[model samples]
Target: MNFSEHFLHFIWKFRLYKTLDLFCVAGEQLRILNPGISNTDAGPDFNQAKLSIGGTYWIGDVEIHLKSSDWLVHGHQQDPAYDAVILHVVHEHDQPIYRKDGSQIPVLVLKNLYPEHLLDHYHQLVNSIHKFPCEKQIGEIEAVVVNGFLSRMMVERLEQKSALVLDKLSRLTGDWESAFYCFMAKSFGFKVNEIPFELLASALPLQVLRKHLDHPLQVEALVFGQAGFLSGSFKDEYPRKLKKEYAFLKKKYGLKPIGVGAWRFLRMRPQNFPTLRLAQFSALVLKSDRLFSKILEIEELSDLIKLLAELPVNPYWIKHYHFQKETKEVKLQLGISSVHHLIINAICLFLFSYGKYADQPQLISRAIKFLELIPPENNTIIGWYKSSGLIVESAFFSQAVLQLNKYYCAQKKCLNCGIGIKILNK
Candidate 1:
C-alpha cells in the first residue's frame, strides 16, 4: 500500500501534522506551535499550524505530503495555500520543491520513522473482508480498543444519519416524536415500501387523529384513508361498517387519502400484507395515549411487552386480516419478540440521546438481556433485511459489537486518533 493510502496513520505516527505545533518551513530547525482540522472531510487533514525553523518562525497555513514530490504530483505547488505553508512534512522525501510564487518550501521526511507493524495491520484491515470496507475481523480487535473504535464508529454512524433526521425533524415542526414515528414507519417499510409508509404518515395527521381518541374505528379510518386502502370496497361485514364510519369521518374531518393502495399484496407472504400491517400499526396508536411518552416511562421489559400486547387493534380484528376474510383466526397479535425488538430499538435510541440525563444504561442493558429470554420471531420480513447486510437479527435489540486489538488500539492518537503525531514519529 502507498503511504497516501493510510494518511491518518501517517499523521498520527508523526507530530508534524498537528495544529498546536510552533514551527516554520525553509529554515534550519522547525518548532511546532499548533495543529488544526483533524476531522475535516476535505482539504488537508490539518488546516492551521504554527512553527519556527531555526531561529526564524513563520506562522501561516499548513500542508501535508506523503513525499516531497507529491507537492507537484498533487498540484499543491500551484495553490496559494502553499505560499503560507509553515512546514512541509513528508513520509518520504524524493526532491526539493517551490510554490507557485517561486519560494522554496522546506520539508521533513517521515517514512524512515513510521512503524512497519502499523502499516501491515492497516493492509490487513483494508484488504481482508470487503463487505463493510473496514469491518472484517474488527471482531478480533482487543476489547478496549474495539470499544473506543466502535464508540467513534457509532458516532460516525449516527452522524451520517443526523442530516436526514434534522430534515425530518424540521418537516414535523420540530417534533421528535413525529419525526421518530416517520422514521420507524419508514424503516418498517424496509426500503421497498419506505416511500409508501412515509406517505402514509404524511397523509395521516396527529391533530385530526386526536378527535377519535376513544374509538379505534375512527383511527382505523384515518389510517386506511391515509393509506388509500378505502377504494377497494373492503368486502367483509366489519369492513363495510368501517367503510361507513370512514366516509362519515372523512367528510367531517376533511380528510383526503394519499392515494396509496394495499402497497402490494399478491406477492406478499400472509403475515406481511400491507392491510394487516397497517391495521396493526393503527391499532397500536389507538391503544396508546402518546405512545412515545408512555414508552419513555416504561422501565420493565415484560411490562413493555404486555403494554404492547394491550394496544388492541379493533376487537373484531382479533380473528381477521381484512375486516372479514373468514381466515383461520390468527389473533392478529404482535408476538412479544416483535414488541421487544421495537422497544429495544426505541430504548437504545432514547438512551443514546438522553444518556447524559441518567445512569441507566446498565438498567437498559439488563432490560435488553431480559428480552433475550423471549423466543425469537422467524419471518421472511427479517431475513430479507438481514440478506441485505442491514441489522435484522433479533439479537440486535442489543448492539453491534466489534472487537479491536493492539494493531488498532495501542497507538495513542493525539495520543489516539489515526491522524496524530505519534504515528508520524513512530
Candidate 2:
C-alpha cells in the first residue's frame, strides 16, 4: 500500500524515524533539534524545523514527499516558497532535488528508519471495511488514551461550532441577539426545516419581534406570517385572527413572507410540524427579553433548561398542529429532549462564542460545564461507538466521539489522531 504525504509528515512530526546513525545524502551526520509545526496551507509541509548538520545548525521549513523526485513533480523547485527549506525528507531517495537557486538540498531517506510494522498496521487500519477504522483495536487502547483524545476532540468540535457562531455574528453586523435569534430559530426547526426557519428569521428581524413581545398574538402573527403559514385561507378562528394581525403587521413592517414551499412536513412527527415550531418560537420570543443576555448570565444547566422550557405554545396550538388541522389536545410544550438538543447545538455554542469574543474564560468554562450536565445525545453515530464497546457518559464525550468519527476516523486521518497514533506506535 502507498503511504500518503500526511503519513510521512506524521512520522517526521513525532520523530518516529530511527535516530541512530542518521545521515544526509552528503554523508554528513544529521540531527533534528525540532521537527517544527505542520503547515496546512500552500508552501512546505512543515514550518520552522530546527536541524543540526555537520556541526552547523539551520532553522527553516521542512518539506516531505514519498520520493525525492516529487520535489520537482510538485513544481516546488520553481516556487520561491521552497527556498527556505533546510531539509528534504522523503521515503525514497530515487533522484536528487534542487532548490530554487539550483543548489542541491540535503535529503533524509526515511524508508528503513521507521518500522515497517507500523506502516503495515496503518495500511491495515485504512484499508479495513469496518465503519470505524479502529473498530477491532479500539477496545485494546488504554482508557486514559481514549479519554485524552476525547477531551481534545470535544474542544475541536466546540471550536468548529464557534466558527459558525462567529460567521453568523459577522453577518448580523455584530448583533449578538440577532445572531442568537437566527441560530435558535434554526435549532427549533430541527433537521427537516432548518433552512426555512433560518430564512424566516432572516426575513423577520429580532427587533421587529421584540417590538411585538408585549402582545403574544401579534408575536405569533409576525412569526407565523413571516414563515408563510398564514398565506392560505384558514377555517380556524385563531389562524384567521393571526392572518388579520399579520396582514396589518406585514404592511406596517414592509415584510414579505417566505414561500410556503420552504417547509417540509412529510414523514415528520406532528409535534415537529413547522406551524407548531413557529408557535413555540414566538412564545420563546415573547417570554424572553434580551435572550442572549440572559443566556450569558445563566449559571446552571437547570436554569437554562427552565428558561427554554418556560415558553409553551398558546392554547390554540395545544389542539392544533397546523391551521385548519385540529387534533386531540396535547400539552404542545417543548420536550425535554428537544430542549436539550437546542441547548447543546445553540445556547452552549453561543455562550462559548461570546466567551471567546469577550475574552472571558469563565463563560467558556461554563459553556463546557453545561455540556457535562446534559446527557449524551442518542443518535446513529453515538450508537455505533457504543456498539464497538466504547462508553459515552456525557454530552462532552459524545460530542468528542462525534468529531473524532466525522473529522478523523471517517476521513481516514488516523495518522493525525492520537488514538490512531497510539495504535500505530504499538
Q: Which candidate is the best by TM-score?
A: 2
- Model 2 quality (TM-score): 0.96
Q: Summarize candidate 1's per-residue lDDT along 1-426 as a digit string, tens digits.
A: 253434543444345343333233343665565544453454554556665667675666556667678778888766664566655666666788876667677775555444566666555544444333333333333445533444554444333444566677677777766766766566445445667877887777666776787887778877876788776676676677767888888888677787665376666555566677777788777777566666666666677778766656566655565545645566576756556556544444543433323555664454445435544344543333234333323343213221111223222122344322222233
Model 2 stretches with alpha carbons more than 4 Å out: none
The ten-residue window of minimal lDDT in model 2 covers 324-333
Clashing pairs in 2: none
lDDT, residue 61, candidate 2 = 91
> What is candidate 1's CA lDDT for residue 259?
66
Candidate 1: regions farther than 4 A off: 1-5, 8-43, 47-52, 55-61, 67-83, 91-102, 129-139, 155-166, 187-192, 251-254, 259-269, 315-319, 322-326, 346-398, 401-426
- Highest lDDT: which candidate? 2
Tens digit of per-residue lDDT, candidate 2, span 1-426: 277988888889999988878999889899999999999999998998999988799999999999898888999878998999989998889998777677889999888898888889989999889989999888888999999999999899989989998998888899999999999999998888999998999999998988877898999999889988888888888889999999999999999999989999999777888888888888899889899998898898998899888775788877888888888776677899999989988998888889999999999999899899899999999888888888899998998999999999999999989999999999
